[model samples]
Target: MVVIAKELLQYEKDYIKYYINFPKIYYKQENDKDYIKNEMIESINELVFEDIMNFMGVVEDSYNISSEEFIHINSITEFQVGYASDNIMSLAIEFSQLAGFYDISYLKGYNYDFKLKKEIILKDLFRESVDYIKILKKYIWVQAKTLLAELQKNEDESLYHIVEDNICLDEENTFYFTSEYLVLPFSSCEIDQEILNLLEFKIPFNKIYHYLSKYAIKNIVKKIVL
Candidate 1:
């Protein structure tokens, strides 16, 4: 089993203050533990710096008032372990802040292989020749239709077309996994709908078993059965 420790990184400046919460993962083997821990920290640091710079740009563009009229910006990052067992570990880090007239939220997912000593991407779990994007998009559409039906019950019919046009997996970080399901989390910003807060689609492993790579089948599928 992999052991995890919580670590907090805080940054403060003239108009910005934020706290980043991450995990320091460990294993029984010293070498393995050090390898995974170092890699995770390095990646997290890069993300944090990138967000800080992005926020600075937004703040500069949003406000023109003096320091006295400025509102303090506080960004908070929280992390959760979606699944961790054997050689596979999946983590989700969520960052939130108030920017301009919007509450901006971003989710970053990391799937690390302890044995491989590297982070996993979406393609890593699927067969090399499989058209995973097309397959996943089909599932997305099915879910969207169901959601549209629900919306039409109480909302205007115009939302149906809007949801259809905006729903898609534009990037890879939107996906992660648990023991029983593959999770796709789409925030309002991603779906291009101000009315929707978050739309999370949890696709069961059985639904996509045929497209899984041998490595994924052995590590994720079979391991889950036991």
Candidate 2:
């Protein structure tokens, strides 16, 4: 898919304002361009709307966000790009004016499947790995629990639940990869205050290699040495 449009999707109010730094992707595959475009647009719409719902809220309620200490909901927006030669795209919400609370931002990944000529989401990357999901959850919680203690808080247990639910080991979490690891983005509320970007939780590709699909492993293998 090629990005045919990049524009702002905006909403404004006296106290609350929201927008998405939207990138409209169009399919380029010759045979199924129309079908692919239809599917991709629908996928992007659903995903982006879900993002709005998850984030759009008043600072005084819902998330219990600190309105007194921080500014009101100025804008809920994201910047995204096709990553790794357009194999997948990564988007991260611009989290600001949240009383310096690290829990306010998130990262997401999207992909266009070459074989299927359709857009694939984060969940499709691991949908078949039920057993692997169980093991990965254990590892993530184990690591998160360690961080919680370092932060000197008893909230780690609750934080674990938050991340776990988002990570249905299916499709809820945002993730991408680098030359070495599959990166799982987390809000500081779930991990720790020290992590400020998409580099929230990096797991070595080797650790989860067995659980990934053949197609996924092909993309990952390029980044990580076996």
Best by lDDT: 1
Model 2 scores worst on lDDT over the 10 consecutive residues at: 94-103
C-alpha TM-score for every candidate: 0.72, 0.58
Best by TM-score: 1
- Runs in model 1 lying further than 4 Å from the true structure: 9-19, 30-74, 99-101, 156-160, 163-165, 170-173, 222-226
RMSD in Å for all candidates: 4.5, 6.4
Candidate 2 achieves a global lDDT of 0.54
Tens-digit lDDT track of model 1 for 18-78: 6767666655554454534355546645665575557555554544453446566666677
Q: What is the lDDT, from 0 to 100, of the residue 194 in candidate 1?
A: 48
Clashing pairs in 1: none
